[model samples]
Target: MLTTDSNKATEIRQAAAKHHGLPLLPRPTDDERDPLRWPRSLKLAALIATAFVNFTANFAGAGLSVASPVLQAQFHKTPNQVNSLLTFNFLLLGVGNLFWVPLGVKFGKRASLLISTLILFAVLVWTAKETAFAGLLAARCLSGFASAAGESIVPSIVTDIFFLHEHAAMMSWYTILVSSATAIGPLVASFIVQYSRGGWVDYVWVCAALAGANTVAIYFLYPESNFNRPKEPLHRVSVTGEDADKVQVVKTETISRHRVSVVSKSWFSIWTSVFTINREINILEVALRPLKMLLRPSVLLATFIYGTSLASQIILIFAFPSLLLAPPYLFSSSQVGLMQIAAIIGFSIGCFAGGYIADIITAVVIRRQTGNVYPEQRLVALIPGCLVAPAGCILIAFACSDKLHWVAIAFGFGMVSFGTIYAPNIAITYVVECYPRVVAECLVAINVFKNLVAFLFLYTAVDWVASSGWTQVYMIMFMLVSLSMLLAIPFYFFGPKWRGQVDISNVSEE
Candidate 1:
């Protein structure tokens, strides 16, 4: 009996060691035993708050576009100069990622969100009230900075609060909210400008009101999600006299320890939580880590893929209005805004196709491969989008060159929108799965590269298309999109091998 007992003890220790030492995998805590025990109502509320934040911020970004003509008249600037508002906004949006994610990682996600939302509300007010062109431009720059939390910080919150099986689906919902704003903002802006005596400022007022309401909701509903997982192994001997021989590691009550209970906190306590600062942050390290992510091969590849897709989207946003408003199409401002409805539908399709399908692929691949889910599993979903997106570009080019019916152009736009959401969603999901330790930093790097590329292309997009005509410019864009998509072929084939080279054991403590 003693010899058998000794052997059993050895086996248990080995099992514990196996779990504790795996760096790529999250350390198993009580939270893993029953993942469904997370507070359903609070989780739903939090998810809604984050989604609203994403919508409000993105709405502000797109809202300015429909009013470009009015802006040009008021500011006495050329079309190019007017578009620079977005240039500044996109540039800072990327740069702001570096700042905001680190703040969330250090200070706390809820606190960072509240602060960012307040800043966004203030900037929108300033944008609405400012009469000078320079003041308006400055407000836009600041608004981009303020709104960075939605893109960089909110996704991390999603990852922090949800399970692996849930990440893709939840992310899809988040993306839907963000993408809908592009279409919805223009609709709101066009109608508000059309009817309101307040004119262009009415759009800003609406955004500000939505943002202010969201800010209040976040303050009351959003709780901190950055719970530090206990390092101790969960398979310890039970202290109960009746169950001395048994291990009770999977109890739902034990899992509750991993969450911070705030249902009972008073108003003052909730308000004061925002002022709490984390002392563990090394400012220099936080600033440099995202830049360092660029050196990782997998990260770099993902960056390029996401960046190319983003640049294409920005190009389409700027170019489509100019194209439709001129010559054969002659679409009104309201009509052009309505055109985004097709893209909105496409994005909705892409979100469901790419996001949930990704989770299914991971499960299928893992089942096929002896129940092991590799990082490369995420790459399979990219192929469908990769092939389809460029086809959309081709369709758009031909339709524009020949002046086909508006529906042809709309269909092409839909395809591009679908691919944009589908491919980038897979890329980001793969990165997080592969490098769970440094998600915040890796995302910051991705955002930086994506925004920089967007700014460069957007600044010159109008001029290039005007000079070369729609067909030629779009053909060139098609080639660029194709090349970026082709780059993924290598990643799909060799991604597992490349991920194997990464020492995920040296994971970020943050």
Candidate 2:
């Protein structure tokens, strides 16, 4: 038993080692089953699997962009109608979060992921075989629905397995895969369509193959990361003696066994466990919780910022074919695909700036604050991103309007990509840190907003650019991106107070 003495408890707490100058948050328990206590290798493997699924999801959604010309000619459709292939997919990707995340909450992240991966594999195969425009559209929409698991559940998994100190770094890794996949997918697809005899359909087949492999990998690599951990103190301290000199401190927390059992279960049993739904969870409430979360200002602001940034990327992707293929540039499909290299370069830098550098800055802030940790402390990382992303938009606008060098346009795309990674990484991470108890719902809300914004912008991208011209449209984008990134400043100062005012007890209650 632990003593209830306040002075001794305080002394023992002071004696404990600190993690980046702060105590471990949502403290891990003595229970070996707690995900936070899992082996480093296991934790990393799970994260890689989750991130790969995210990569595959985005790759499938955007890879077809490079093939737009081929697709338009094949389907005998207008540009806007053709763009619907990607736009509708984006819409369902957001809407699907509403469905899959609730199911993940009820069934298990691992289980939900497995089911979604299987569905994604089937849809990819269907997409490869579809000959008609409507068939391809339906197939792509289903793929988006299946892909939502990557967007919504991944952040929750990161929270489950990683400490607060590790969140930014881990999320950066996930975001790199996601953002890079979007950029790289087109690069790969452009080459495939340009060189392959099957043209655009070859890209769909490749995605299907990857999705099939991903399903098998998920089965083996991703176990149930969702552990219902009990709330406990950071550590329990007991003073064994009354004498100041003679007192002994006993640390009570111990791992009796490793979290993972070595005994192997039958494949069927594992499958059944993954599919089993938890009766205790309220399905309806889980589904509606994300919608309810939108009422919170922090949630809305974070989602809006993230949504607009993502939409900017979508619009750029939609416009690329039209601008590069038809303009004075008259670039080949392969050349257009290579343009993504610039975005990838930006993603690489942003990943380092947003993830590792942000983590370092956050630790410094915590130390300076005398070990006090706040969610807003992480916002400092967004400063560079806020400035860079909007500038990138302006550069792109000018490059297009003046018919500047292709390198200038590529550089602008790179800048916007940098901002996309930098700002949203902080925004989404901040929301999760603020509402640790309701991470899934918060992520669902962000994804819904992100996809909705992307869907609307992308659906109208062709006509919007055609009617307004690139300069006017991108200038408007510059304003929207700048305003959204700037909003973080106010939130950084007053977010804590505002967060306190919101009531999430009802939604988070078991």
Candidate 3:
């Protein structure tokens, strides 16, 4: 038995050193243990709780549209002015990541998650109660700021917890929640406002209810997932010796023993972890890291891909309600809400398929390229999605402009939703893998770029479509999206060369 255990540990150490250029395992502090080492059920519970919080945050952001008309009537605000609610909220959502992500880096993820969720809950309550338009807008700004945690911080959380092979599928869940929340928020909110006497207030209250539930769930379920392992390899080795040619061998029995011991901590001790900060964190360095990463070719490529993909979705969010309310279709708010269900279906398919497809395609590419997976292999997965997304945009433009059947319009919307979904899941997984040392910073850059691009679309989309006609407006979007995705071609081929140029000195694991 002792000899077998020695051989297993030797194989793991050799594999880790050969493949990862790092240690088999560090002398872990209480918080420095890998989250993957946790029991399967505990890790799964953590994922579900985190995803629910993500859903609640996005649900709040996307539901603002359903409340716009009632808000306009009550406050005598113009449609354009009401739209500013989304505009400013999105702006804050992007910019807020600069601060929130750094704080997550400086403090533990559980602390950051708890603090943000609590703030989101309070803002939702204020949004529910506020009668003044200005007050409501102010509340949403804070809400967006707080809710930035879901997009910017959660992906890093996934990276911290899951292994490289699991990232694509795990990230797909985050992408799905974000897209589904955007579509479903309006579907649920439109009906509530249309039927309930409480109107917009009722919708806000629903968001608040979900927010409260998410807060409690997170408090009970989410533990600190950040684990800073040593750069140097461990000195210990198995008696059997090194097998550098083989893949890493993880010993399940050994990990299970560690899980049993570590996870047995009391609930009170876990709760107090919200106040724990990463002692190695340098706040100033954390604030500046994303900006530096923005200059990297791989990072910039992800920005364009994710940013353009997000812009297409934002345009649809604003366009659907405006267009359906006017002209031949003359749909009610509830009907318009139902129209978004098409998008939900598309997003679900995209989210579910993107993960597996990316993983499979990447594996194939890896086998062909070097018999070892490279981060750039993930780019191949985006090719199909890139082509499909632009085509979907063109379809939407033609369908809406030609006054085609509602089914035609719905199909176009779904195609666009489905196509756009692929870009983020692939891009995020690729980039995170590429810069595991600075996952938070890379995500902050991506969010900032994506949100800024989406903000531009939000402000210009309605007017552009109205003035240029849907064909012209969508054609322009298609062109931009195509160009962005095309950029991936060069990266797919030459990404390693570009990545080699990056200055690792700027990267801090803390």
Indicate which candidate wins on lDDT.
Answer: 2
List, residue by residue over 47-81, the lDDT tens digit for candidate 3: 88887777887788888786677778899988888
Q: Write the per-residue lDDT of candidate 1 for residues 1-510, one digit (tens) a residue.
A: 999866654454444322221111232344532212346576777788877887887788877787788888888999999998878887887888888887887787787788898999999999989999888889999998988887866666667666555567677777677766766787678777767889779888888999899889988877766655443221222121333233221222232233333333334644556644657666567767788777776778778777777676667777777888888999888888888888888888889888877766654444344334556667776765677778888898889778899999889888888877787777787777766667778888988888887788888988988888778877877887788778777887787676654332234421
TM-score of each: 0.84, 0.88, 0.87
Off by over 4 Å in 1: 1-28, 31-37, 230-272, 500-510
lDDT of each: 0.72, 0.79, 0.76
Residue range 1-510, candidate 2, lDDT tens digits: 356566554554454323343345566666665677766776788889878888998899999988887788888888888888898888898899998988888888888888899999999988888888888899999999999898979988999988877788889888888888889899999999999999888888889888888788778876676777664322223334344333333332322111223233334543445664677789888888888788766787877777777777767877898899876999999998999999999999988888877876776665554445678888877875578888888999889888899999999999999877877887778888877778899899989987887777888888998899989988988899989877878888987787764445354421
For candidate 2, the lDDT comes to: 0.79
Q: Candidate 1 overall Cα lDDT vs. reference?
A: 0.72
Clashing residue pairs in candidate 3 are: 10-238
Score candidate 3 by TM-score against the native: 0.87
The TM-score ranking, best first, is 2, 3, 1
